[model samples]
Target: MRLFEDNIHIEIPGRSTPSARSPEAEPSLDGKVNSVSRREAVEAFLRLRLFMPERQKRIVATCMNGEERQYFFDKMVEIAATVEGMPVTYQQDGNGDETIAHLHYFLGDCHWYITEKDREGEVEQAFGYAILHGDLINAEYGYIPITELVDTGVGAELDFHFKPTPMAQIKQALEDRYG
Candidate 1:
């Protein structure tokens, strides 16, 4: 097992904790219960209600503390519901794949995710571009804390794919609840 740090991959030989999903569902190519499958990734995102507007949610499941995971998911949903609604243009870099971004209203945090694939078209690595950490502050509405996500490459920028007709209602609900 290994923990990949900021742009650096480190290897460690040891037993890893079990995944949140079932082992029957997350099998590896070599018949090992090792890496998270794409299906598991999507399931994790959906279960957490995380949103990635530009790219499809194809991230691997990662182990994170409850606070960090909540921060990331909370930000993801808020961004999808508010600022960037569906039918929005998907922004891609020169390689023709989309680059995703999201805004967190809690502390006005925004993040940009850039995913790079390998020669076999499998996800090789992912990096965050506009990774901003929000500071805890008092706003006109209420308390706002700086937000942060787990450092693992498990997070994705969920897109707002629903109809715009119901967006206004959703945004109002968020403002009302979070305020």
Candidate 2:
């Protein structure tokens, strides 16, 4: 099995692991995010997070040792929490979930997502929530030096998506080519 296929889990300080949640329960910070499905939230988060300037750079730093990986990972977790808390600050639904959210993150690249049927031939997303689909990665995050998911053109593509370009690598590529 692939390391990421169904094993995608991000650690939030207060939230349970995605692997631990029920098939219907999507992991949220304070309580259950029943309004927006887990898959949608995570995908929305991913769609925005990967495009950050700092985050884009972190993708390149993946070559670092284990300790460094932990450091960057922690930073990302922090970003996710900050974003999640944004909408909830105003008001909450009867379900204690927020309906309106402002995704201040992915405004840079105009990199939104278009979901096709997932590998299982099913897919969905929510405007209130977002997730980081390392699986849906097709473009490089602005400075991150990681290879992204390529469109297989066989099974359905993830409806939620983001565009990433390794800012660091692009700079390096330019330097190597010119200098």
Candidate 3:
């Protein structure tokens, strides 16, 4: 995977450098490609999670971040500290379901969630949400299903998926609650 930070490209295994005109690329100085910062990438990623349906976001995230859930939470803490000016503290809530998983973040009395609705193949769906003061503030919701583990010449692989949420809705919610 190739990650671009400020037009500097860092290539990961199995990822190639995209051409300047690639959809994921942006022309930078002398035809170099620029990419968003890690914080920006993380924010975009979290925002996108709200729109995914059920386990779709879970699958995509598994693919991108591998099986270590801590990586995802670590990034969230980074965002909370740097962008939200919140402490690096969080609490979680979920039902004890393997096929369906919910990762919740309680920050500053607000709740945020990235959830997978189907893990054992009952259904496939995933989403992200935020609530403040007992009111639903922002959400990204979508549904897609992956019935089985994918094998890419390695061991069993988990699926992580996500979709884009409305920026205006999220922005307004944050401004009202945190501003």
User: What C-alpha lDDT, on a 0 to 100 scale, does residue 168 get in candidate 3?
Assistant: 45
Q: Give the better candidate number (1 or 3) by lDDT.
A: 3
Candidate 1 clashes between residue pairs 3 or more apart in a chain or in different chains: 51-158, 52-157, 52-158, 52-159, 53-157, 53-158, 53-159, 134-146
For each candidate in turn, the TM-score is 0.21, 0.22, 0.21
Give model 3's TM-score versus the native structure.
0.21
- lDDT for each of the candidates? 0.32, 0.33, 0.38
Writing each residue's lDDT as its tens digit, candidate 2 over 128-178 gives 222243222343322111113222122122221222222334334434644
- The per-residue C-alpha lDDT of model 3 at residue 76 equals 42
Error of 2 at 93 (Å): 19
In model 2, how large is the Cα lDDT of residue 56? 38
lDDT string for model 1 (20-104, tens) is: 4344343343545444434443444554342332123333234222212333343334443343232222222342223332232
- Candidate 2, residue 60: the lDDT equals 25
Compose the digit string of candidate 3's lDDT tens values, residues 70-137. 34444444433332321111221232222122343333454444344333323233343545554543
Models ranked on lDDT: 3, 2, 1
- Backbone clashes, candidate 3: 26
Candidate 2 lDDT (Cα, 0 to 1): 0.33
